[model samples]
Target chain A: MSETAKSSALRGAAKSARVHVMRSQLGRVRGLGAAHGGTHHWWAERLTGIALVPLSLWFIYAALHLSGEPRSYVVRWAGNPINAALLAALVLATFHHAQLGLQAVVDDYIHHKRTRLVVLLLIRGAAALLALIALFAVLKLAISG
Target chain B: MKDIRDALMVGRTSDGRLVHRPLSPHLQVYRPQITSVLSILHRATGIALSVGTLLLVWWLAAAATGDAAYAGVSAFMRSPIGVLLLLGWTASLWYHFCAGLRHLGWDAGFGLDLPQVHRSGRAVVIAAAVLTLLTWIVGLAVM
Candidate 1:
């Protein structure tokens, strides 16, 4: 065969290989069905990333001011509605983002399959628990004070 | 011959090599860049936030447990070392927050070019500093 013909054949082979890989990927997608589990976690992380830009700055200011205050004064400041709301938002966003990021780290670096799974679960569970407790405290203070 | 036990075991290949496939290379080969460093910092802040959450929980738990526990935490917060750590954590939070916004921009198909990436990276740093300083100023004013 001519060199041109051989080149054309090689191109055809490459095309076929690409198509095969695409089909295999499609098959995997079909098998997985409508179980898009990580989407909300990802969206929450991104949303927090955006929210944190302002919230984090506010948190820093709030923390610095609170640095020298007595327990009663600090509690009263946090009990204010605006401060309480912002603090609650910050805690929630921080925990959500931390969970997503830690999950990615566990997936990437942990070699022991079982341990990796456990760690991922623990990170997520801890994040949720912490957020809940913080929210409860914020609510209590916001309502009572 | 010395005996060695394989905790995760598969059979050897016919060529007498272990049948382990090489992992895709990680961040080793590429020279460190500002973007790369910022990316790592993003992860570090994430881990810090995880620990910070525990601190938040402690604070809340103290509040729940009553005045004595709350006073203990409040006293710690007043300590010089504790204040410094809080300041550092606050800075980390702001820095991470800015960098994360930059990352989100990149994810949305913006700022992918080399110049833009570096520019955004610099912006993240400068913005964080400006924010921290502003925060401290406001904090001192309130105090």
Candidate 2:
């Protein structure tokens, strides 16, 4: 078989691999497209969530002790190398989880394709910005301490 | 239900005519039950926690910025409204945590039977409440 024929055959196999039903054709229906990387998204969300289980519990315990404490106290808390490291981990996991969860919410709630796309991008940007700002704060406090 | 019913999803036919799909029953149509309530609560608290991150970041930024900046945030946090927000966040955090664990269990093919599901749902609610109350109690005593 010619190279083109072989490649076309491979392409045909890939398209057929997709789950389809009778009276269905590609792009024939709206609101039926696969998320493509859905499993990855679900798995990553769970992984980050598992990491957060310990990180968040520890944070809550530490934060309770620091309640109504001064800014210097907070600085000292974050200044501890272990605290700083764990706190950094917490921030990253938090924003990542938040972004993924919020993205799912947006995907479900926003009916308009363009609106959903724009909102998702905005969420991605906001989560990154917040996470970076937090990490920066932790770094500054750790260094100053 | 009212707002959600707006903008029924439209499908395109082979010949390019628009066809709207039938709407799924909305929130108001459901009879309230523990399982359903907890499911909605899980998502609600997750979204709430996401919003709470803004305040967390704000406090951290204020502290890093300087004493004056931190003092400003401190004042707000001590205010009645700020205190309420903090309490709400703490509760939301705990609730989301418990519900999330329950979710993980279900994903792993556990506690999925009808009775087990209901049992776990109640457990999550109670656990979240106890945790939140304990945190605030400890927080005040330590403070």
Instruction: Provide TM-scores for the models.
Output: 0.71, 0.81
Clash pairs of candidate 1? Answer: none
**Number of the predicted model whose DockQ against the real structure is largest:** 2
Candidate 2 yields a Cα-based lDDT of 0.88
lDDT of 1 at B80: 95
How accurate locally is residue A72 in candidate 2, as Cα lDDT from 0 to 100?
83
The deviation in Å at residue A26 for candidate 2 is: 12
Query: All candidates' lDDT scores?
Result: 0.75, 0.88
* lDDT of candidate 2 over A1-145, digit per residue (tens): 9999999999888777664543345634542434424667889999999999999999998887677888888998889999999989999999999999998888777888888889999999999999999999989999984
**Chain A TM-score values, per prediction:** 0.69, 0.75
Q: Which ten-residue region of model 1 chain B has the weakest summed lDDT?
A: B1-10
Q: Which portions of model 2 show Cα errors greater than 4 Å? A: A1-36, B1-24
